[model samples]
Target: MAASGKKNNILKVLLIIVLIIGLVAAWLGYQAFMSPSIATSEDYFYVHTDEPYESVIKRIEDEGIVKNPTYFKYVAKSMDLQNGIKPGRYKLSKDLSNRRFIGNLRGGYQEAVPFRFQNLRLKENFAGALGKSFEADSTTFLNILNNETIAEKYGFNKDNFFSMFIPNTYEIYWNTKPEEIIDRFASEYKKFWNADRKAKAAALDMTPEQVSVLASIVKGEALHVDEMPEIAGLYINRLKRGMLLQADPTVIFANNDFTIRRVLNRHLTIDNPYNTYRYKGLPPGPIMMPSIASIDAVLNYNHHDYIYMCAKDDFSGYHNFAKTVAEHQINARKFQQALDARNIKK
Candidate 1:
């Protein structure tokens, strides 16, 4: 009878030990699968296209994004994440749990990348910047930008293609194709030429394209926002009188050299249509990417009789405007002297 009692007691103790083990296992499973697995380290993780599973897991471990890579792997495998990997830019947060984090990636949930276009001096530079910002490479982007056939679809040429891109920020997926980017910007350009802006352009007796052309020159000439209107007014005066634009910026564009600090007589004689001195109207396209401010300044140009402008000799990033050639020559001479004193021969 005592032997039977001893056996019963031993069995009861064994059952209790089994129950404790099961509870511990359950807790660990919950922690691994349901609790947060990401650390408070980074706010983003980009799972590049065509990346293999092991590389991604290793990268997650290397970046300390996961609290425990082993546990993460276990949870991922259990959740069928091995067959569900999707490439994209994923948002990371410490509050993200293992299940939520893995599920978000598996479902292809991604953050939109902010792409900004501004102050790009050339299309090649713009393409390079876009390549770094998006999935499209610069060669592909440049090909699309320069393709005469494709450019015609957007009403653009190799030189005026940049006008389609309004300088602003766009939130788009990182893997957006080059064609889609072009289409989106074309849509934006079309949308920007609304009835009101179109009427303003018509009031100036100009096409939207012509406004962009003049705005680019105004932007090139003016360093301060306040000077843009006056500079634009001076150009408008010249245009009204059928005078040669004679814009130095256009000459620089014609020379294909932006480093010319002083426009010499030789530079003015460039035979290209873009050379405003040689041409009687606005350049065939914009000389540079005009900003919205510059465009608005042209649309709402200040009414004035000034037909000429020269950079201020005071070096205050302002310009001196005059209605007569004599006054403009004086201002030009002063600015030229300043440039010569500083040895800016180019």
Candidate 2:
């Protein structure tokens, strides 16, 4: 009876020990899927190209997503995610489990960054915008864009390179390199300059680049959309007659002072390739990033006998086009009077 009692006690102890072990196993299993791990408030995690899983773990800790880096690394290794790490942007969940986190990292589940650009003044400005949201820095992107050899590969110069970036929202990875973005732009440029546009440009004796240049000028001059085609027509007429464009916007560009509300005689004297007052043809490149609407307006310019354009004195964002110098002088004097009334002399 004593030996029987002793064996029964031993069996009870073994049962308790086994229950503890089973409970521990269940808790660990729950930790794998049910427990919350990520603590970040941000929406996503950005994994760069060629980044290792260890580096990702470090970022997880650095970003305050995971409280325990060591345990997260252990979980990642156990799930065979160390070598299966993907390079991309990933969505971050607040209540993300270890298993789901590992799965997301292992699978190339990247969030497409909403990359957008518009109304850019210079290549450096574009680079600054990109650097704010992307991994590539301003100087790095500018160097690649301004490099003669790299620009040659894309068949662009620093001057015309701004024309390639169509102002639109693009879904691209944050880790996108300069070369990849440029290639995408090149594709977009090809799509924009379709066979029909090419045919029209040929009819006008202009290349797509030349059209973009004129479009930039038209865009600079006209604030109202309805005036774009009219301004485009006047410039086309001037170009056909081999007359000087004498665009105030081109003078502003030559002066490099965007703040100059009015182009004076002094501004026109600055001799640069962009000075349409001195140069008889289109500038070497676009003065600003022209919109698609402006570009298309140039492609289908109105047939007009006008060779000059001046802003209206009423400040209606419209222009008065003229076939003779005397008419332009009349329009200019009216606008000058308006400018004088507003104390705008520059």
Top lDDT prediction, candidate number: 1
Task: Flag regions of model 1 displaced more than 4 Å.
Answer: 1-4, 39-42, 61-64
lDDT of each: 0.87, 0.84
Question: Candidate 2 clashing pairs?
Answer: none
**Cα RMSD for candidate 1?**
2.3
Off by over 4 Å in 2: 1-13, 50-55, 67-70
lDDT of 2 by residue, 98-130 (tens): 778778878876777788887776777888887
TM-score of 1: 0.91
TM-score of each: 0.91, 0.89
> Per-residue lDDT for 196-306 in model 1, tens only?
899999999998888988999999988888888888998999999999988988999899998888889999887999999988998877888888889989999999999
The per-prediction tally of clashing pairs is 0, 0
lDDT of 1 at 103: 92
